[model samples]
Target: MKRWRHLALLLMLMTLALLALPAYLERAELQLWLLGPAWCG
Candidate 1:
């Protein structure tokens, strides 16, 4: 039972990370966009 609970928690965390990834990537892209010109030149 304890092992099952741990597995469930791990699965939930993985799911949450997958869901959050796109938003994280969008924020990263926005940051790059904001700084892109300065870096490029």
Candidate 2:
């Protein structure tokens, strides 16, 4: 296998992870932040 092809595959996997994790975290943070006011009060 060539170097660029391997690098491209690695980059593609990284981009996919970035897209998935942020959306997951966003939903998680929204839930946590919403509960913060009640918990703190």
Candidate 3:
């Protein structure tokens, strides 16, 4: 029972992180796009 609970918590966290990854990548991409040229020049 305790192990099951821990597994469920781990699964939930993994799901949340998977869901958030795209948005995090998108934000990073946008930041790079917005700032890339300035840095390059």
Worst window of 10 by summed lDDT in candidate 1: 32-41
Model 1 local distance difference test score: 0.98
- Ten consecutive residues with minimal summed lDDT in candidate 3? 32-41
TM-score of each: 0.64, 0.50, 0.62
Clashing pairs in model 2, backbone N/Cα/C closer than 3 A: none
Q: Write the per-residue lDDT of candidate 1 for residues 1-41, one digit (tens) a residue.
A: 99999999999999999999999999999999999999998
Highest lDDT against the true fold, candidate: 3
Q: Write the per-residue lDDT of candidate 2 for residues 1-41, one digit (tens) a residue.
A: 69999999999999999989989899989988999899899
lDDT of each: 0.98, 0.93, 0.99
lDDT of 3: 0.99
Evaluated against the true structure, the overall lDDT of model 2 is 0.93
- Sorting all predicted structures by TM-score, with the top scorer first, yields 1, 3, 2
Top TM-score: which candidate number?
Answer: 1
Q: Give the clashing pairs for model 3.
A: none
lDDT of 3 at 12: 100
